[model samples]
Target: MKKCPNCSADVEEVFELCWNCNYSFSEQKVIEIKDYTIQEGNREVNCLRCDIPLIFSGRYDFHEGARLGAWGNLFELFVNSERFDLYMCPKCGKVEFFIPLNDSEYKKS
Candidate 1:
């Protein structure tokens, strides 16, 4: 359910942007939602000072669990079985990460 190329409103697929004019759909639709579960791989971390090549972005779960406590009435069933890959280094934000089954250079396309 994503249709807001720029004002065509009705966008809410965990929106990246576009709140009716804030369009930012650079086309990145890798959706496989049947209750949530997508895990791809490609890890080779290295960029803490200058070593490049850090890519491994895949692992998201939302199968009816994610409401956190405090007035929100906790509800974190099935939590996360370890799935995080979001590295960034836009020049200096230098960030590194690797957690794909224990980072043995994860490679599961």
Candidate 2:
């Protein structure tokens, strides 16, 4: 473990940025985290590493392409129609995709 030079918070050696204060050890400065994500749903989710609210990118649908290649046909069955919601952290630029919860769960006001 190592201590952040800016915030004096203990940070794992593997991580470059301090989790508590977004300080970059290599850059020797505090990382600016101005963008915060606001999801349409009321479901509040935070980044595991940065501990900041994640921005809801959008919803995406996956399906087989019109033209199948040699290996494409092999995995064709695996690439069925699927919908997923995408989320990303503005601070750390970390991304996460999840199967969306029930629509009723996000009754936007």
Worst 10 residues of 2 by lDDT: 100-109
- Shift of residue 51 alpha carbon in model 2, Å: 0.3
**True-vs-predicted CA distance for residue 96, candidate 2, Å:** 1.0
**Model 2 alpha-carbon miss at residue 85, Å:** 0.7
lDDT of 2 at 23: 93
For 1-109, candidate 2 gives per-residue lDDT tens digits of 9999888999999999999999988899998976444344444679999999998888876675553577776766565466668889999999888866664443222
**TM-score per candidate, in order?**
0.22, 0.43
Identify the runs in model 2 with alpha carbons over 4 angstroms from their true place: 1-40, 64-79, 103-109
Taking the tens digit of each residue's C-alpha lDDT, what string does model 1 give over 14-87? Answer: 87776656666765433332422334454445667767665544554323445666733434433444445667
**lDDT over C-alpha atoms for residue 12 of model 2:** 93
Residue 82 miss distance in model 2 (angstroms): 1.1
